[model samples]
Target: MPLALALSPFLVLGFGALLIMLAEAFGSRRGGMALGSTIVLFATGLTAAGLWMYGLENLKGLEAVAPWLLLDRFTLFFQMLLCLGSALAALTAGGYLPEHELDRGEFYALLLFATFGAMMVSASGDLLTLFLGLETMSLGAYAMTAFRKASPRATEGALKYFLLGSFAAAILLYGFALLYGATGHTDLAGISKVLRAGAVKDPMVVTSLVLILVGLVFKVSAVPFHAWTPDAYEGAPTPATTYMAVVVKAGAFAMMLRILLTAFGDAQSMSWSAGWPPVLAGIAVLTMTVANLVAGRQESVKRMLAYSSIAHAGYLLVGVVATMRAPQQAGASVLFYLLGYTVSTAGAFAALVLCGSRGRETVSYEDLAGIGRRHPAVALPLAFFALSLAGIPPTVGFFAKWFVFRAAVESGFYVLTIVAFLNSVLGAYYYIRVLVYMYMREPAVGAPVAVPMRSGYVVAAVILSAVMVIVLGVAPSDTLDVAVAAALSPG
Candidate 1:
């Protein structure tokens, strides 16, 4: 395939991100027509079309367009997810803005840029490119989180996220520098070779590995590194929160897997499987246990959901650990979980959007009272999402968790598997509690009742997310089989 054709999806995303900036400059006055929605849809369409062409022409694996990027199947897989998630978020914001009187073009622009950044991260083949991509995505995300500049909590969330994210970024870059200094190469493939040659045992390499793990741990919200998650998720704009929860983590983990599989995949290094696996296993155990236990005690629905998201991150780390121990099937499980997570979380957030008339609710647990009686559509979808998060059967989350556990048990990581299973049972309590409030309790007197669904974007997002969750949950065999085939064999 032609290089331009290979690079089209990313280039389209980049141009689209910039286009939104241009539109912001010139189109600020014309905010009422859902122009933000239009731009996102058009960009998403462009991305889908480009990827379709690539697939039709048998374009798979890395297509090196520069020293920085490697357009490959792995990258395309995440790129498609990011674009779809971003489009869903845009539509969500579209539906949400009008009701809240905050409909503005810049909101869509930030969403596009954030997605574009995620695309860059997936496509990156070099550390410098990855760092650049991370910053682009992070910066855009911070802006979106605080888009409600008027809200003190929103501003506070943005500041906390930004400060902490900046620290993580710096640590990651330092780690990259150490890797480069030790290996004398910046490309991922080269780093793996250097490490395997005994260079990674050097003190510099050891320091670099720990620092790099710290940075990624922060990204994945692992225990001892997850303090900012609940606050940020609660304070950010809900649509932004959804985007961060789904797309950002997915993108970050994609890179995390790539780095582990490529740059660090050297049995001779002693750090590849031996070093990281136990560390991750420990982190996963604590992350799952702590997040779920804390989540169960939260009074605010949004805060509780935020903790649930953190626990899910721990579940994903289990999949990552599987990559080291059971390479082929485990990697596929990670991708599956990411897709499942994106769909379920997006659907759940859409329900939250419906409940609030202007922006999100104060979101007290009492706010959910009588929703099941008054608004079946919103209430049921929320219930489905909560069930999905809890890994209940007949939901995609069940299959996602099942695969990870299967991979772990196959690799003889019985203890980790058991802990994860127990966490799921613990998590179900809080997830089900929200449902109980919605269905069993009486509506708080004069609580805001959900209005009718409005906007094509809103309807599309909800329908698409709901359908995906059910279909994937019921018959994930096809997708899982394909992902298995595509996954690289563990080192």
Candidate 2:
């Protein structure tokens, strides 16, 4: 394959970001930016699919950018995932921004740029590229969090995110510096070679590993590092929150996988007796338990979903821990779970977006009271997504959890799996509560009820996401096959 073809996905997104930025500055019409962003994202996804079909490793000149960016099945998988996620977010924004009177071409531009950064994160093969991608993604996210300039909540959330994110970045960079000092290598593969050559016992190596894990855990919003999540999610525009929930999380996980597997996959670092798995398992248990417990207490629906996102990250961490013992199956499980999670989460947020208009947006459980009676079209899909998030049968969320737990079982993590299952049950309570409010409860007398917004963009996103959740849930073989293939061919 031509080098251009090998790099098509990245090129397409990069170029699209530039074009969208130019359009935002020069174009008169704001109506088309969302549509334009959607088109670019779809095109980028198709490009990744094309590369996957062509077999990324077989392509000549793929190493033209060797040690910096990798064109692999894993990268392609995340590229497609990020593109689809960003497109859905863009569609949601099309409805959400205008309804809330914050529509601007720049929002779409920032979204594209953020997505481009995420793609870079997935494709990165070197620490330099990874850090670059991380900051790029983080900057866009900070701006998006502050998009609602008139809202003090938005400003506070953005400020906290920016400050904390910068601190995390500094920690990560210091870790990288320590690694370089210890091994004299910055490339992940080179660092791995050094470790495998018997540098693993170095105290500096261990310290660096601890620092790096802290940084990555913060990015994923794991427990103790998750204080910023609910506030940011609740304060940002709905569409931006959705993007953060899916795309940003996906990118962070991608980066984590790359670093851990490539640079720290040695026996000492990977061992359950001594390595990262035990730590991650503990984090998974705490993240799931804490998030679920707190989520059930949240009065705001969006904030509840934010905690739900953290809980799902905990589930993904279970799969991550399993990778220490069953690399292929556990890794595939992680990819598949994220695929299911991306659609289910995006759908849930879209449903939330549809459940409200400008002044009457759904916030509390009471705001959703009688929504099913008022608009079954909106309520039905919301119910489906909510049930799916709860891991109900015949939904993608169920299968996703099944795969992760199966991987854990195969890896001999019985206690962790049991705890996760119990947490899943606990999580269902909050999700089901939303449905009960919508279907069973009635609004208080004279209280403002949430009204469904009318927008083809939001409806399209919701329907597509819901259908994907169902289709992938019912017949996941093809998607699973792709995930397995990607997993077997590690970056």
TM-score of each: 0.93, 0.99
How would you encode candidate 2's per-residue C-alpha lDDT over 325-372 as one tens digit per residue?
888899989999998999999999999999999998898888999999
Candidate 1: lDDT over CA atoms? 0.79
Q: Could you say which candidate leads in lDDT?
A: 2
Identify the runs in model 2 with alpha carbons over 4 angstroms from their true place: 488-491
Clashes of each: 1, 0
lDDT scores for all predictions? 0.79, 0.92
lDDT by residue (430-467, candidate 1, tens digit) is 99998999899986677665454556666667888889
lDDT of 1 at 466: 83
Clashing pairs in 2: none
Model 2 whole-model lDDT (C-alpha atoms): 0.92
Q: Name the 10 consecutive residues with the lowest summed lDDT in model 2.
A: 482-491
